[model samples]
Target: MRESFYRYLMTKRDPNGIDEISHFANAAFFDQAFPKHSDDYHEISHYLELNATYLPSMSVFDEAWQGYLEEVI
Candidate 1:
C-alpha cells in the first residue's frame, strides 16, 4: 500500500519539475513510516496527521489515497 501510494504521488509530479521537493519528501516519509507494510487508510491518515509537518497538506495525501484506490479497485 505504501509503495502504491508513492507511485500514485509520482504520477502527480509536475512535468517541469517544480513539485519534486514535496513529492520526494512525501516519498521519503512513506518509506520511513511504512518500510515493510501498510494497508489501512485510517492508520495511514492518522500517521500523516501526527507527522503533518512533513507534508504540504492532508489534501495531498487524500488525493494520492484516491488515486491508489482507483488503481487497485
Candidate 2:
C-alpha cells in the first residue's frame, strides 16, 4: 500500500513531493484526493494486475529499486 501510494504521488503529483505526501496523505487525504465514489485504489491495483503480463519489468510488486553505496572502512 505504501509503495502504491508512493507510485501514485510520483506519477500523478510531483516526484519530489513525497515528504509532503506522507504528511498529508492519510485516510482523509485519500478521500479528498480521489472522488468520494471513485474506486481509485482498486483501479490502480487492477491496472497493475492487468498489465502484469504485458510488462514483466514493471509489475505490481516490481519497484524501481536503487541501492545506496556502502562506505569501506
Shift in Å, residue 31, candidate 2: 25
Taken over the whole model, the C-alpha lDDT of each candidate is 0.60, 0.33
TM-scores for the candidates = 0.59, 0.23
In model 2, which runs have C-alpha deviations exceeding 4 angstroms? 1-8, 11-39, 53-73
Q: Supply the global lDDT for candidate 2.
A: 0.33
For candidate 1, write residues 1-73 as lDDT tens digits: 2455544455565545556445744454455565225556787778777855667778867766776787765
Worst 10 residues of 2 by lDDT: 64-73
| RMSD to the hidden true structure, all candidates | 4.1, 11.6
- Highest-TM-score candidate: 1
Sequence-dependent TM-score of model 2: 0.23
Q: What are the runs in model 1 whose C-alpha is more than 4 Å off?
A: 1-16, 20-26, 29-31
